[model samples]
Target: MNPMAAMKAYAAVQGGGMPTGGAAPAAAPGFGEMLQNVMGDMTKQTRAAETQMTGAIQGQSNMIDVVTSVSSAEASLETVIAVRDQVIQAYQEIMRMPI
Candidate 1:
């Protein structure tokens, strides 16, 4: 997945899920599911980029296309890392709160 698509999906998952002030729908996925989806997408993008790189090395894929794919994969990776860091920070903050 491209960075934009990944980011959009992230936003959709993060957006105020419960309609207005009502309870969230039972069909809504939990945080774990959202994180899993992001990780899966990231892995897919990385794999595609790797395949492009391999093709380029074999003189089959265009160098420009390979570069673009690799850059997109890198951006998506950075986005995922940033999200992971945010989640970890949030967890640490919650752990410090008095019960």
Candidate 2:
């Protein structure tokens, strides 16, 4: 079983749809902007992981630090992939609707 399988399942079940109630539009970030921010963070984590691994190789960082950073980056990557897959699935589902 994938480590993120539960998270992915929860995300899929949530549907991530827009709110139907009347709320301040400015209070919430737009979907596109939120996704962009997540992408940026993922990039940063990947870079950080690489740096940690390099430091470990040079004996500047411990194996524990390297392992933790790499694990974090891997989790982020999996999250991004799960989000991408969900978005694609949503798009496909929308396309199948008879309008």
Candidate 3:
């Protein structure tokens, strides 16, 4: 399945869904700003994960909790980068197209 569809499914599975409506939901607040905010949040989460992992290795935290959080953060960051790359490529391709 496409990435967006997969994301929607994952969100639903994670209980992120709201009720369906007859009309489309309002555009999310901050539209373009939201992307930047998300990227920033992902970076913060990744850093936190790395810190947790380091602490775990140093006997400051439990290994299992560190492993799970780090893996999840890594996966989320990778997904964000992949989506950003796809969007940039699509924009570039569109710009090259003749009117």
Candidate 4:
């Protein structure tokens, strides 16, 4: 899996369409939009990994491709988990502040 291609796919998904040969959009995405986009990308990567694994099991896909897909999915899940942990920690700190 090419990193550039994966990034491009992410960008396209976040943009809500295929990337055009132009400058970035002017408006910033809302938190909900960003979360939705990230979830969508994660789902795509997970599905790709599953498909690759099934194909490999059937001798239709290369082991390297399956490994790459699985690794990508694992990395994405780790990133999500790290973000969640930070968010939870931040909330805890906020709750601990003198009110």
Best by lDDT: 1
In model 4, the clashing pairs are: none
Estimate, for each residue in 34-98, the C-alpha lDDT of model 3 and write its tens digit.
46655766777688788898898799988888987787677768867887898899999999999
List the lowest-lDDT window of 10 residues for candidate 2.
1-10
52-94: candidate 1 lDDT, tens digit per residue: 9999999999999999888878887898889889989999999
What residue pairs are clashing in model 1?
none
What does candidate 2's lDDT look like per residue over 1-99, in tens digits?
134544544454465567578963334455776677677777888899899999998999999989988898888788889899999999999999999
TM-score of each: 0.77, 0.74, 0.64, 0.72
Write model 4 residue lDDT over 12-94, tens digit each, in one string.
55766544788675455665666666677778899999999999999999999999999999888776677679889999999
Each model's C-alpha lDDT?
A: 0.81, 0.76, 0.69, 0.77
Compare the candidates by TM-score and give the number of the best one.
Answer: 1
**Candidate 4: segments with Cα more than 4 A from true spot:** 1-25
Model 2 clash pairs are none
For model 1, the stretches where C-alpha displacement exceeds 4 angstroms are 1-4, 7-11, 14-26
Better of 1 and 3 by TM-score: 1
